[model samples]
Target: MALSEAEWKRRQEEEDAEPAYFGMTWGEFDRLPERKQQETRQRLSQLGATHVGFWKDCTLGKCRRARRCIGFLSEAQYKAGYNAAYPPCARGEEPRRAKIYYDGICRLFPEGDEQPKYDGRRKTGEEDE
Candidate 1:
């Protein structure tokens, strides 16, 4: 059924009020320091080079083990390894590092806001809230 204009406007406002992932929008991601952005892009590109193909194949139901992939052993398995190998930031707390890295990777692709939200505590002085 079609909604009235008032309902539609209210829904739009509610969506707009929703918090962004890691409390950051694409605009904020773009405004990060150039060095940080470059580093993030580089890390994401390297990750994509190594894993994107496999991930795509698995997601498209083209992999033999796609159905078996689950829980802690799922796609995040590679992410954990990547995080350990690359280590997003050297000077921040775990939560902050996770947020930065998560946001960094999310911003690397189109429709990034549709990516999963990073679940972590906000750093004391960061703008995330």
Candidate 2:
């Protein structure tokens, strides 16, 4: 059933109140310990928080299909750009761009890897460890 207009507005307000974080909601991120949050921020900086272009057959979903580097930016900047493009409660199927972005980062910086690598193969049957 369709939500009432008031209910829709309320939800929009709630989404607006909570910021966006990659792979999770802002509220979830905020609930983490203060030190953990700081560590996360620091870690992103240490990794350079570079934006990895979408994989050829990205497992997350259909990619944006751009044939060039998407340009590196800080996490904050990426989040802002994502929100501007696809805000919360956006009507229709969820876009894959954000998930692609997150998955790209993970692939580039898999745990224990001394340096990032470019892997464009599809992760059809791979599981996150």
Best by TM-score: 2
Per-residue CA lDDT of candidate 2, range 12-81, in tens?
6687558544565666777788645654553342232224333333322223354323233335544554
Q: Show model 1 residue runs off by greater than 4 Å.
A: 1-24, 52-129
Give the TM-scores of the predictions, in the order they appear.
0.23, 0.26
Pairs clashing within candidate 1: none
Candidate 2's displacement at residue 64, Å, is: 35
Per-model clash counts, in order, read 0, 0
> What is the Å distance of residue 71 in model 2 from its true position?
25
Q: lDDT values of the candidates?
A: 0.43, 0.45
Number of clashes in model 2?
0
